[model samples]
Target: MPSLHEFATWEPLLRLLRTGNAGNLAVPGGHVAGQISHYGWSLPLQRRIPRPGQAAQVEDVQDEFDAVQRVQGALADIGADTISFTAEISPTGRSVLHLISPGPAVEPGIGGPHPGSLILVEDSVPEPWRRLPDPVPGAVPAPSVDLASLERTLRERVPGAVGATEAEIAATEARLGVALPDELKVLYRVTRARWEDWGEDHAVAERVFTAVGCELFPLDDLYIADASSRPCPWRFGAREAVVTPPDAAVQGLVGSPGWIAFGDNGGGDRIAVDLTPGPRGHTGQIIMLSHEDNIGAGLLADSLSQLVLEGRGPGRRGRHGDGPPAVARVNIRSLDSVRAAAHAGLEVLSLGVWEGAPFSLAPVTGLPRLRTLTAYPGTLADPMEIAELTVLEFLELGPEDWRVLVDAGAVPRGLSAAAIEVHGSRHPLQVVALANELLTLWDRPPITRTIVEGHLEPGV
Candidate 1:
């Protein structure tokens, strides 16, 4: 197996990059950048156009595919998650490559050539994820709940279904460290949903799904859908807020310990019995934790009984009101200026690419709830103003902006996590230098860089 640091591992890919982006490489300060992992790669090579009346295929870019697959094989052999590279080639074809390994604390950038993230505080999570559901003192099952009707419906639909034994139910309760809701216990009692019980028949499984109104998990697979179960990167997760309106039927939380995941919605969403309800909600209400969202669950049904019997609940309940937006993005296409996005409720402030003068952060300096701030390179008029945001927990800035904060010893100590936003063809080693500087302030592990010096022939 070729090592990831070997010139042979990256030679083919570098040749392809040089060949495809010849014009870009010939110019002054011109370079090409991309990322690769064991799974796949993000290269800037252009794809060949398909012939008239023909569809494009992998064969259209077979050379690029094969080249990348070779590097991917090396990555797999070396057990490396991901690596980013910056290649600069002269008009005569001489090239210098810089291979950057993002060490342990940083998360790989998504879908592009990014420097990845710098995790400042280890094992630290966002504020919303830390929030637990507010206790509902007098919560009880909804009036529509009918245990007898629900049992009868299940028995009628899945007539020959095998039910769970009392011993099996008790074992599940013990494993979960919480008692099963009465309606849920009744559900498994009618049909244990074991594949072995149905002799691994697909039709029987489908029948159970239809009768149960979801793809039911076996008794042993039941789990608490707590916040920890759904993990999100600090950069994006810190921007979310847990907001449960006064009239909300389900508490808007990252995840609740009371959420007992019993089944799936067939679309990867978890269908759970929410033991923790909102102000106007029933104790054992049905809710759905969307796989795509990280914050809250959607109220699916008032109860498990209501769901199985009627095939639906009181429809989808609104999670947030039309209050002031919690997140704000300032860019050419977004809220033109920071002042327009400023309010007491603002939690996230992001400054994107700007063509005009650099903006000051003074507008939101003293915002009590502001915790996340990410600025695009050169967008900030004064990066030093960030020191005024004493409550920031997550901050992502371009390397230059971060330098301003670091040089003045004003890197917000309250930040639990931070990220370096790399734009264009900045060298990854420089990004790592800035990342290490930030990590050093928090006494966290520094990002290690592996410089694998290699040269490529003009076009191989």
Candidate 2:
């Protein structure tokens, strides 16, 4: 097990990088950067052209594969997740490499050269994720619900199926801390749907799927699909808002504590019995949480009985309607300016890359609901204007913008989370310095960096 700091651990990878970026390394201030994990690498190496009349294969890039695998083996030995490196090679082939470890509390960047997010506040989550369904006082089961008919239908559909005992049902309720909906209990009473009951027979499982109208979970596998169950990174999650409309039959939420997940839609979506109904919804209506979406559910059926019998609902509609837009983006393609997106309803304001002049934040300074502001590096006319946004809970800014805020002692004390957005080839150490300053204000742990110095011989 070679040490990560040893020159041998990184020599092969560095040699490949030096060769691939030789042209750039000959010039002043030129460097090559990329990330590597146990799975693969994202280096700036040139791809070899396959000979005519042949398709590309792994063997074509064998050199790159072997180089990355050597580094991965060292990483596995050292128990590190991933490493990002920046290497600058002089024309004489003297190289300096800086290896960066994503310290605890930082989310790794997804499939790119970008550094991942820095979590400022520990265990803090976005407001929408923390939102609970508003109580629906007048909600009741739909008129179409019939417990006796549902039980009788299931019994006839799958004859001789083993059912869950009353004690088992009670044990499940105690495990989840919530009572099973009457409709779900009835379905499980007809067939517990455990694999052991049906043995290795594929036809029995198919019959259960046909009878239940969805892939049913065994009694022991039932879980509450709470907001915590569906996790999202703070950068994207902060931009979402839960807005259940007046006419919506299902409450728009990240997840509901009342959502008792009982089955799947066969495409990885969770089918749950929503106990916390919307203003116009029944208490036991069936809804689905899409695996692709971060927020909100779609109404599936009025009840479990309706789902198993008719296999459809009145209409499949999202829980949220065209309420006042809560998130606004100001960039080249989005709203032209801040003023155009200003309103009391706005909660998330993102300033992206722009072709026009930098914009001021004055238009939205006093808006009561604004809580998140993410500005691309140099998009703000005055970064100091962020101080006026007194209630911001999540703030993401480029290194320079954050420096301005940190230097003036105005890095929004109310922020529950923050991120440093880096563009181009800025050093990770510089980003860590800015992030530490922000974290220090909140008394959070600082990001630690490990520097490994090594040199590569000049490529022939």
lDDT of 2 by residue, 1-460 (tens): 5677677787787887888888877777887778899877788888988889988998888878887888888888889978887777787767687777767666766564455666767888999989988999999998878899888888888999999999999999999999998999999889999998999688998899889888899999999999999999888899998887889888888898899998888899888999998888899999988899998888889998888887855337654566557888989898899998899999999999898899999999989999999999889999999999988999989888888877788788888888888877676567767766776787766666666666666554
Poorly placed runs, candidate 2 (over 4 Å): 38-41, 46-55, 90-93, 313-315, 319-323, 457-460
Please provide, for model 1 over 49-152, each residue's C-alpha lDDT reduced to its tens digit, 9 standing for 90 to 100: 78899899877788888878888887778778888878787766566777777777777877665656677778888889899999989898999889999999
Each prediction's whole-model lDDT (CA): 0.86, 0.84
Q: Which consecutive 10 residues in model 1 have the weakest lDDT in total?
A: 450-459
So what's the TM-score on candidate 2?
A: 0.91
Clashes of each: 0, 0
- TM-score (C-alpha) between model 1 and the true structure: 0.93
Give the TM-scores of the predictions, in the order they appear. Answer: 0.93, 0.91
RMSD of model 1 against the true structure? 2.3
Q: Which candidate is the best by lDDT?
A: 1
